[model samples]
Target: MQSVADGSQSSEVPNVLGDFALHLSAQRGLSAHTVRAYTSDLEQLFLFAQGQGVESYAEMELSTLRGWLAEMASRQLSRSTVARRGAAARTFFEWAARTGRIEQDPAARLASPRQHKVLPTVLAVNSAATLMDAARDLAVEGGPADLRVWACVELIYATGARVGEIVDLDVRDVDLDQRSVRVLGKGDRERIVPFGVPAAAALRAWLERGRPALATWSTADALFVGQRGQRWGQRQVRDAVHRLSAIAGVDDVAPHDLRHSAATHLLQGGSDLRTVQEVLGHATLATTQRYTHVSAERLRSSYQLAHPRA
Candidate 1:
């Protein structure tokens, strides 16, 4: 058994977990994205154990792991984050057993906290319009930043992509000739989403005038840039959305809401469930079905207003 730094066995120890992560990524057909997340989770756990003066993962008992989770709970990490961490721990221990690094899977009986099925929040059609108009109004000089702001918000609502996918987008990502933007989403999975004339126009405006103005010798291949002349970060894009939503008088509007609104509106306009799911890059049909609830609510409102019933 590995000795703890404090010379006490509290069921927490640190080991070189990177090799296991690499094995999972290469041999198990796990995506790089998942491998990164799992490794990060292990790193966090290792750091936490070290802070407590524990030496290795093999020394960690179920109760020690539970204590770490309880600490995370006290810090209010969301249920989803907690669940992911639990899954990471479980997988790591199981891998350790398979590789003969451990005698048993210490995380075998551990379970993640149940997550709440929170329905996504979406902007009303009028509110979405307000958001677009507000972003357009903020485009001062029609410069790249302004153009980027315009294009980002417009296409987010139009294409419903996660902000990272948008930030990582390259020049070739947008095919104006095809009227679609190619998005590489989580797991490096690629999909092409169609946008209307307005989104295409905004993108063209940015590419022609805005992007050139912001372009530098050191500029990467990214389509969006910050004031620092570098590619846009996820936080920067999210902050842009937050600020624009505030200006649009819809403070709760987020990048994801634009996605939700886009999917919801498509369904409202008679697009099928599977089509929206494909457009949104959802992995499960049930995940795509939540919009049905939103549509039913809208229908109920329409019936109430038009039925002429007392």
Candidate 2:
């Protein structure tokens, strides 16, 4: 971790940040992506502090943290990005205080802006059906790549797993007999998410027909593989979803839209919020509640179309 601060700033800042990053990855089990994000946020904060002539963590104050946030706002950063940065500051300061690196936690009083609750975009029932039909048709073309794409979309829609989790899956993680997949989600939490029979059939076809065509000794036991017979990447999965959606005449949809559609469809079909949360591997019920809003909006639209009163 190189110092983002100026020459006048304390070198200890970078050292402490390096230690914190290590702790997050080794002890707290945070994913590499999360650790990188937190470290980046803290580096920006340190650079801001250097500009303010605050050379050490011990000199940090609530007002200084607030000024940094105000600077972010001035730069027109998104609410989610500012909020995440605030959270990163809070967590870092808390750790510093607990570990006796700092005399007090300046960010203890810091507050993150409330994240706006925007409903995720989901495919309508007809559109989702069309997209899956397109993928099925592609699979019927008998190409290894087409079969893999069909299986990926089927598993995503069937289980609502994140693209990262889907790509991380190994052959041992999928249980065809149980119709479930073992997902390793954020914070390294593991959960078993169930898929429907359609997904099972697609998965079986890919395993029997598609994967063998691509697989090599170097492919190991990954459930999904790329054209080069290595583990599938999230970007490739997302691109495949986008391309398939466009072919189905539903443009601008991503892999996550399939997840959102799965959750919303489940709610519309009478699945409870808690069950959806568990299936989606959401840490909080509040995170899962967003799908309820999507379901309600769809119901209202349907009612408006069918009711006698205008």
Q: Which candidate is the best by TM-score?
A: 2
Candidate 1 residue spans exceeding 4 A from truth: 1-16, 24-37, 43-78, 138-142, 296-310
Each prediction's total of clashing residue pairs, residues at least 3 apart in sequence or on different chains, is: 9, 0
lDDT per residue for candidate 2 within 172-283, as digits (tens), equals: 9999999999999988899999998989989999999999999878877898999998999999998888888788898579889899999999998889999999999998
Ten-residue stretch with the least lDDT total in model 2: 1-10
- lDDT by residue for model 1 over 164-281, one digit each (tens)? 6888888878899889989887655689999998888888888888888776666657788778778878888888888887777875777888999999999988999999998999
Model 1 residue 13 lDDT score: 35
Model 1 local distance difference test score: 0.81
**How displaced is residue 217 in candidate 1, in Å?**
2.4
Give lDDT: candidate 2, residue 173.
94
After superposing candidate 2, which stretches have Cα over 4 Å from the reference? 1-11, 303-310
Q: Kindly provide the TM-score of model 1 when superposed on the true structure, using C-alpha atoms.
A: 0.79
